[model samples]
Target: NLCSKNKINPLIGSAGVSAVPMAARVSNKVGLESDAQNFLLMHAMGPNVAGVIGSAIAAGVMLKYVLAM
Candidate 1:
């Protein structure tokens, strides 16, 4: 819903799939396809890294909660 509201593809998470620099490279590659000068590797990586961190924290919290049940 948020992505649609902002006109962003909900499938954007694919860029963070591997959590590797290659993912960033792929991001730039995809952007280049749209516009040769458009580079999004660095910018996308910011959120990719943040997502990895957030996912780790979320996983930890879920583990704790599930174990407590």
Candidate 2:
């Protein structure tokens, strides 16, 4: 939604999952299919990497609390 509002392809934004570079590659491939010059890999990767790290941190926190309980 943020990407859509900002005028970026939603596909790229959605690629920001915990899957990392694979998702980014898929986004890039899809973008290239639409337009040869649509380079979205690097842009998508930014969010992808962050998502992985964030997910890891979140999981750690959840586990810590669960184990404590």
Candidate 3:
């Protein structure tokens, strides 16, 4: 459950952050439609797979920091 929750949370956050700016710029420049904007947002987030990768990277950094201390 924890992993599932972690996975969803980061993915949502990434998508939200990437999509908001993307939507604004895209809407202003090209007048993209809703579905197209959603697609761009999804692709910009680098997929659900990236969330696990990010988590691993974060854990590695933390581990290194702990060991250094």
Q: Pick by lDDT: which candidate is best?
A: 2
- Model 2's TM-score against the true structure: 0.84
Q: At residue 12, what lDDT does model 3 achieve?
A: 39
lDDT of 2 by residue, 6-26 (tens): 666777677879996799999
The lDDT for every candidate, in the order shown, is 0.72, 0.87, 0.47
Evaluated at residue 58, the lDDT of candidate 2 is 99
Worst 10 residues of 3 by lDDT: 9-18
Candidate 1, residues 1-69, lDDT tens digits: the string is 654556553224656654766777777788788878876777767767877788899899999999999
Runs of candidate 2 exceeding 4 Å displacement: 1-6
Q: Which of the two, 1 or 3, has more lDDT?
A: 1
Flag the better candidate by TM-score, 2 or 3. 2
lDDT of 3 by residue, 1-69 (tens): 555645332223434332444533443333234343443444434543465566678899999999999
Q: What is the descending lDDT order?
A: 2, 1, 3
Clashes of each: 0, 0, 0
Range of the 10 consecutive residues with the lowest summed lDDT in candidate 1: 3-12
